[model samples]
Target: MAEPAPRGITSADLEAVPAPLVAEILDGVLETHPRPRHAMAAGELAGELIPPFAPPFARGRGGPGGWVFMIEPELHFGPQVVVPDLAGWRRGRLPAEPATPFVETPPDWACAILSPSKARLDRGPKRRIYAEAGVAHLWLLDPADGELEAFALTEGRWLLVGTVRRGEMVALAPYDAVPFPLDALFPLDAPAAPTET
Candidate 1:
């Protein structure tokens, strides 16, 4: 039988690892999961999706804005330190930035870009942790399937708000302030050449 997974990942477990590696301290065990082929591309794609909204909610320059969204923010909840693909906070709740490198307060919203290698952890343990941390909204993006699923926490349980498939434009909370085009999140290989008649 395979050895049982560690009870939880600790910060020390990740100390020796190189900076290039992506790792998270889930529950209490150190998880160094494999990186998927599209993980970097998916992360970059996520970075692109936010600029359009930055002027409005993120920086609070205009619009019905009251949010601060960040990419790959290091979050600390109790003894656990987890990093989500994207994390957002209501400006009112976090008037000032934390002095520490990692914020202890849980984010109001978080988005996780799914990859084959990290899907299980993101959907399972990571989801549970986010719920426990009192995240109000959650979004999961699957690049391979070109899908985005949004959920809201109801009494600490996740209730599906909606799902956006490739080629579909959707406005899902809490970012529903603006509609997002699924295709824009994942770019296509290239334009097909016209066939000669």
Candidate 2:
């Protein structure tokens, strides 16, 4: 006989896991999704890149200024809960400080820095979830490739707005107040010099 599928997991099940562990819900099942080294580095790089242009609005790190720009914030949408690499909410949408641990208001913008382990899931289930939750803008950053893809929600579906390859400069929406360079998100270490044979 074939092995049985695992029981459907819920938000409560995820809550039972240790705080250090990261969990995401998909199709009513809970899954462990940890950030790899590059993924974490990419998120930090993004955290640095987004704040300067978003001044006057509170994004986390320096201070809770105006907007709620958070890294790996837990988002609850109906029965599904997700933690994107980064998420932000405009001050107008959330006037006061968020009183709850999990934000249900849905983010105005969300970024997912993809690693090999998560590229498929992020591009598929997570993308669909964000669209269903009505997230306005989505950014997919591939740290290894130094590529960025921006998407905007239109008519209840996600449409590719633009893409920035390595070493190129492009302004992404929801934060296009200034043009941002793609290479900033992924800094390359100096290549070792060739040995004299």
Candidate 3:
């Protein structure tokens, strides 16, 4: 009989492997994995089904001047090969597209959703990696807390632009024209009522 799969893979193991090998592995895993959160967010934003605003593009856009892509990037940060939840890059700064889905180039903006499985990675090391990459914008969304934190790159460092909490309204940087209601991001449930004894 075949040996059972290992319980977990160490960062050392990941570091020892080549980047191309890592990309190949991630491509296979991502292809078979059904990312419901990504799909739900993308779908809700499509076809005017959700609120009205500029249409969101995925995997970046390419044009004469430059291109921007919303990519699920794989990064070799220290000993770990991190696949950020979402990333975007301008054409001028990106590497030539590879045949595989994962992009080696860092993005201009990176967003990570808080998940129980990788919460620390997203909030800690990943934040530092994006800052080091000089990403202009970083959005850390905590679905559990129903909060959105925005960070901007300033002099090669990250500055907290703002934090929007549930029921608060705030405009995001790079897209200041867009106004988002904080509560809209959370589950669609009726607001709690005041109780009087």
Query: What TM-score, over all chains together, does every model reach?
Result: 0.80, 0.80, 0.59
Candidate 3 residue 177 C-alpha distance from true site, Å: 2.5
Per-residue CA lDDT of model 2 for 17-96, tens digit only, reads 66756777766666675554665555655565456534563244343344557778889898777888888787788666
Model 1 lDDT per residue over 1-197, tens place = 11223655445555655676667776666666554466554565555445545445345433356667777777887766678888888877677888876788899999888887778888998898999999999889887776789999999899999987766676888766656466665555432233343
lDDT of 3 by residue, 127-160 (tens): 7767776678988777667677889999987899
Ranked candidates, highest lDDT first: 2, 1, 3
Model 1 TM-score on a 0 to 1 scale: 0.80
**How many times do residue backbones clash in model 2?**
4
Superposition error at 33 for model 3 (Å): 13
User: 1 or 3, which is superior by lDDT?
Assistant: 1
What are the lDDT scores of the predictions, listed in order? 0.72, 0.73, 0.53
For candidate 3, which ten residues in a row score worst on lDDT?
Answer: 23-32
